[model samples]
Target: MLPTRYVRHSPPKETTTSSVNEPKISVQVLVLGDIGRSPRMQYHAMSIAKHGGRVDFIGYQESTLNPGLVENSLITIVPLQPPPSLLRSNTLPFIFAGPLKVLWQIWSLYYTLGYQTKPARWLLVQNPPSIPTLFIALIICFFRNTHLIIDWHNYGWTILAGTKGPTHPFVMLSKHYEAILGSFAPTASFTVTNAMAKQLRSRPYNVRSPILTLHDRPAAIFQPISNSEARRAFLARIPETSGFAAAIMAGETKLLVSSTSWTPDEDFSLLLTALCHYAESTDKLPPILAIITGKGPQKQMYLDRIASLTSTSKLQNITVATAWLTAQDYATLLACADLGVCLHKSSSGVDLPMKVVDMFGAGLPVVGYAAYESWEELVKEGINGRGFTKSEELAAVFEELFADREGKQLARLRKGAVEEGSRRWDEEWDSVAGRLFGLCD
Candidate 1:
């Protein structure tokens, strides 16, 4: 349940002279989306609290939040009401729906920032809902004398362009809106990638911000389940694997996991096609239990398609299950799985997938889509994971990686993934964001 009222925390006092010189820190970590789905911002709140700063975490509480965030004394979860029903209706075209949603969001955000919350030294906000958020945040910061920091996950305009064509008037206007407001608070901006920083520095966007690249890293909960007993216990709890329990436990079948939002960015058809090809191949590869998790608009459509395929016996050698697991169960599944498949086709070519990071943290190798240039930063082809651009290519990669009876290639990739996973959230966050926010000693 969401907290019904706001309560602020004061930072602990120290008598040291250095403490006297340091700035008093309190930040409102704002996300204009679901709080549970916004892991990056969640990490930010945790890191801030760890560094002795107080955080008011604000977002819609549509899903379960991390207990760590909820339990922290330094962090407060402030829930925002979800948008109006009319804004969510598919019958309403975006041309009309977009403006109405923005207007409501502006009022809600203003009320929360202006009156409902305590005044803070900094306001760290997520971008890509940059439309009303950037505008409203700027206004609130100006009036309340709070410093604004925009964390650039991706461009709102580019994401908008993905649905409506790049030439759409709204897309163009959104780009201008982002460019104008996003350029403010020049020294206080952070981006997820160097590519984003470079883009923002050049051309029409020409942001003056001292953009720091703070890459996403897996949280502490995601770790390798090397103990066979632990793996067995996890598998036993998931009823979806009951049909092929022996095969999976005895290493006669492979567990392949993937997470998706079932959004337009990911083409599930490609994965289905590759799985079909894998089943038909006369290869030595084991049968697969492909489990995809997450809820989205296209989830039902894909579920129907998977059902249709199963009814016709087209996927005889493969079993597909879709689940909406809790965060802990999701981490355990990643740790127990043999491999992960990431179908993310980044809407903004500069943004990297957090799922890939989570998979690596579980010591699981990945087979990721290679459509975007930024994937190279995380995938590290032939090392930590392999990349494929087509269904046939994916099938071929799977055959090569999984066909060996000795499991040589899989072992090699898992070693690389484990090494990659060792570079975790705390170390990365403390160096970059910790210093930028003046939370470091």
Candidate 2:
């Protein structure tokens, strides 16, 4: 049987010449990135499907999707073709590969939307890979008479500036392209943060769009563990974590967990340096087993560093483990851990980290990076979590949180996280996005 959330209420059968139970609206939810990795778009599709709207869900099928989404009858998965393999070659210059990749995506996306799929009433797309996607989606929507809605996750230009300097001609050009096309749907667009919406409305971009802020919320699977035994049972099931189960269950070791994409935005070095501080300190702190999860381009590079750090006699109190967990297992692991640590320094300060949202949902206190101004919006320092810009600051926070063996401070933060997690995705979506999509009153 499907989970209660997955179970759909089928519309009544047609009684006359016209189908009475047919969905009144059909939406095309687009993401240029991997569908499995894009949880926000998936949630949008699920919400649409739940409210009797047909959703043509489109993106690259890079990983396993949520079972609930896969089982949804009202939603259709429209897989986008992955870009050329040459794009990944380190030897091939990006100047040559970048244009080729964009051209390929343009042709592929145009073909998928124009020829393969049926026309949707609304076309909702994720931005940041905005160059060709936004242009191509705009053309398709214009010709098809569909309403175009750009879901601004972050600025493509800002993310590009991370690699190429902000002054670079290519980055500047990309910014203009994004800003112009993104401003098309003035009143119908959405953003993840108010700061982003404010920027679009005020700056050189000057978007007329009333970009609504639709904050990310945890899915139903992200819930607090009821007891120690339940947490231990969950830990024992995963092969990578099974060895630490007994120690965790016995309360002899503090379990710290973090999830990362091993991307450029996340400063893993800060986390490693902080742990090094914890190891070298003379203070008698409890042994910590830090589990860093996620697979990405930079995983092996960090894994080698972890290996070198452990070889030295200077770091004895800390054990660092890495794993790529299934979605359900990841939630369970977060619930079982003592604390959550985030290193996601957002490319645009406005956007919040969904990983932090997931941690709070599992009732775990977080210690997150504080370089970005927007960190305060999600992680209220000294409340649900603490934020630090430097390794020393993070190390000090760890000392303070873990100083008491009884964990009074950790308990207080955990209580705050539980309160924050009380609100789930369904209610949030119904209240905000449901109205925008005309799915609910």
Identify the candidate with maximal lDDT.
1
Models, CA RMSD each:
4.2, 5.9
Question: Model 1 over residues 1-441: C-alpha lDDT tens digits?
Answer: 112233224332322223323424778999999999999999999998877777899989998888889888878898887788879887798879888888889888888877778778789999978979888888767665677889999888888888998999999999888898887653378888888888888876788868888999999989998888888878887887766666777888989999999998888988999988898888667889999999899999999999999898889789999888888899999998888999988777889889999999999999999888678878888889999989999989878877887788988999999999999999999999898778774
What residue runs in model 1 are displaced by over 4 Å at the alpha carbon?
1-24
Q: Which window of ten consecutive residues has the lowest lDDT sum in model 2?
A: 11-20
Superposition error at 404 for model 1 (Å): 1.2
Off by over 4 Å in 2: 1-21, 185-187
Overlapping backbone residue pairs in candidate 2 total 0
Clashing residue pairs in candidate 1 (N, C-alpha, C atoms within 3 angstroms): 186-209
Q: Assess candidate 2 and give its TM-score to the true structure.
A: 0.94
lDDT, candidates in the order shown: 0.85, 0.83
Q: Positional deviation of 292 in candidate 1, in angstroms? A: 0.5
